[model samples]
Target: MNKYLWRRIKYFILCIAGLLLALLIWGVIEPYYLDREAVVAEIPLLSPSWQGKKIAVVSDFQIGMWMANTRTVAQSIDRIVAERPAAALIAGDFVYKPGDNLTPELDRVIQLVRPLVVAQIPTYAVLGNHDYGAKAVTEASASDIQRADRIQQALEASGIQVLKNEAIVLPNADRTAENDRLYLVGIGAYLPKQSQPQQAIAQVPSSAARFVLMHNPGSFAELPPGTAPIAVAGHTHGGQIRIPFLPEWSWMSFVEERSSWSWISQIRGDIVRVSGWIPGYGNADNRLYINRGIGFSNLPIRFNCRPELTVFTLQAKT
Candidate 1:
């Protein structure tokens, strides 16, 4: 009887080990397969002049991270341009962990997305926490100011507009510019010293058709309910790895929560009240869509979850 029990225990241990090995392989290779999703948002206060507009949104490019492919992002840009989107929006984190290679990193990042400028897509962007050297494990550093400046300059040079705590008005062609203006508000990075959401919305008119761009979902809390028609973000990277049906048990969640303490929060108890993983759209007055993002942050492995490219079409409510 004792010998039989020992043999059974050995077999069970071996099975667990084999399963773990298979999962590790899946995680390591999954990131290469990029995924695309379509976002259709209905804005009640949308400008009739700007109806049926298509916008492309991407975020968290973390270019310098291990195993993150720049080519993949360029290909995604190709796809976006093919759709002929009116504008492209980058939520933030153009480069990952610049460390001492700030200039080169920024240059490469710009070069990767230059095709958008060439396509005349009028790309707009907002900085993410990583762009300012702020991570889940650490706060923004003093020296990150230089990194942030270089990123902004590179983006501007590429003809991509950078917005921080500001608003811009794009004239609607169908109607006269006087009354039909599209308001785009780019909020600051959701990090210390740079996070100024109130100032970001200060200039936006309540009546103008508005869409808020942010990198962190945490910033979504600042906007008044029902006032913001749509807000897009990408800090969570779609949880980096989403299991089909089992979200709470996703391998990334166990490690991800540790990297960022505030990963769990209560925003009317609707901020991913799931198993704590699986990134998706949430219903609210603002109607937020958090893109899965294109790059990896702390970990290089991704299983079930792939890099995301979101193409959004804005429809005005009748």
Candidate 2:
């Protein structure tokens, strides 16, 4: 080969090598890096006394997955404790494929989340599809119910309140007056039709500031207008591998469709909505925020998407 052609060949080889190295770091190293995102939310009807209080949100531990990011989960919880948020919210999917034996996974999950209890930070959670072992079961079976209950019991034992279609008024450090209270409503997983937004919201007094916690973003649609001033969710994992400018190529699409992958879904942008605020969702009064959780599913690698711990500062709406 001539000198110019040889130079061209060398350049081509170097470009290919560089691309592989980038992909390797993105897919392997990125997943292990946890991101702490701070956001400010202005909630309607929020009490002045509760203004500027921070709430930490994390989700989808998926403990049993091969090469799961359990270390990240533990570290994230520790950070939440250190931040000393008024409360920490776990959006769910505590284990991945615990199968018939859930004891080991449950123990691992409890151990990872125990730090929050030790730190005395109030924590709340809701179960996801994986926790119920009903990823594919639209109608929950007896086994599924048992699995969900076991997971819930373990979390509760570890000092995390597992709310299923329940609402509680968060006690304010200042006062217990009606105007000072903020309601937190947590509903069940949307998969298997377990989420009951109406029933959960019923417990919240009207004209009070309320926030909802759920495992699936789909549940936000079930909420009536003005019921959820703000809501938080997980289970998308930010598409697990978000291709820049090509969100439609997310791997979550395949998992959601589950054997019915289609060009139409891609063209219509039906891929799972990922982290941060979801635009044009729910009524004008309802807002939803999805957290990018610190775990893996379908595969253990993540590219262009890092695990997240969200710290939200609540501001009283003007």
Candidate 3:
């Protein structure tokens, strides 16, 4: 071959090699790199005392997935403790699917989250479909409900409060407060037809300060207006293997099979919100923040989307 032709062939070969290396890093190495994201959310209904306090959000710790990111989960929990947030909210999917032998998997999950309880950070959680032993919303069954209860028991025993269609009024940062408490309304898993947003907030007064937590972002629509000044959720896992700016081409786009469940279609676009805040995502009066949780779904790989631990600093709107 001529010198010019040889150089052109070499250039083509180099380009292919570069592309392979990039894919390797994206799929293999990126899954382990935890991104500690700091976000600021303004809750107009928030009490002055609640302002400036930080709340850490994380989810989708599919602990039993093939080659799960357990190290990343532990590190992320440690980071939350170090930040000393007012509270830590775990969105759900504490386990992928532990099958009939659930004890060892549950034990690992407890070990990972024990620090938040030990540090007295007032951690709270809600269950996702995976935690209920169902891979899809339509797959939920009575057996799955029993499985979910076992997981809830493990989490509560670890001192991490798990809410299922329940609401808790958080005490102010200082112990002296008697009123103006911030309400934390946690909706249950969308599976097994367990999530009940209306009932979760029925006890919360109309003018009270509050936020909503659930595993599926689709549940945001069920919440009444003004009830969720801010809502947090995890389930998409930021599409697990996003294609960066071209999020429409994320892995979820290709992998999501057609389903009768309305929410299944929206997940392809949810990857766009990846690791930060989205204002007025559901109801114009409400805001939603989606966290790119720390684990895998069906595949143990992450591309541009790194595991995330979101630290949200609360500010009262004027």
Using lDDT as the measure, the top candidate is 2
* Clashes per candidate, residues 3 or more apart or on different chains: 0, 0, 0
Per-residue lDDT of model 2, residues 1-318, tens digit only: 899999999999999999989897779878778999999988988888888999999999999999999879988988998899988999989998857888899888988988899998889999998887766538788888888899988888888999999999876687658788888999998776688888999998887888899988777877888788789999788888878877546777667645222212222235435678876667658888989899998889888788999999999887
Per-residue lDDT of candidate 1, residues 176-215 (tens digit) = 6555777788987776457666777778877777778888
TM-score of every candidate:
0.87, 0.91, 0.90
Off by over 4 Å in 2: 1-14, 246-249, 258-273
Task: Name every residue pair that clashes in candidate 1.
Answer: none
Decide which is better by lDDT, 1 or 2: 2
**What's the TM for model 3?**
0.90
Query: In terms of TM-score, which candidate is stronger, 1 or 2?
Result: 2
lDDT for 212 (candidate 3): 82
Off by over 4 Å in 3: 1-14, 173-178, 264-275
Error of 1 at 39 (Å): 1.6
User: Which residue pairs show backbone clashes in model 3?
Assistant: none
Q: What is the total number of backbone clashes in candidate 2?
A: 0
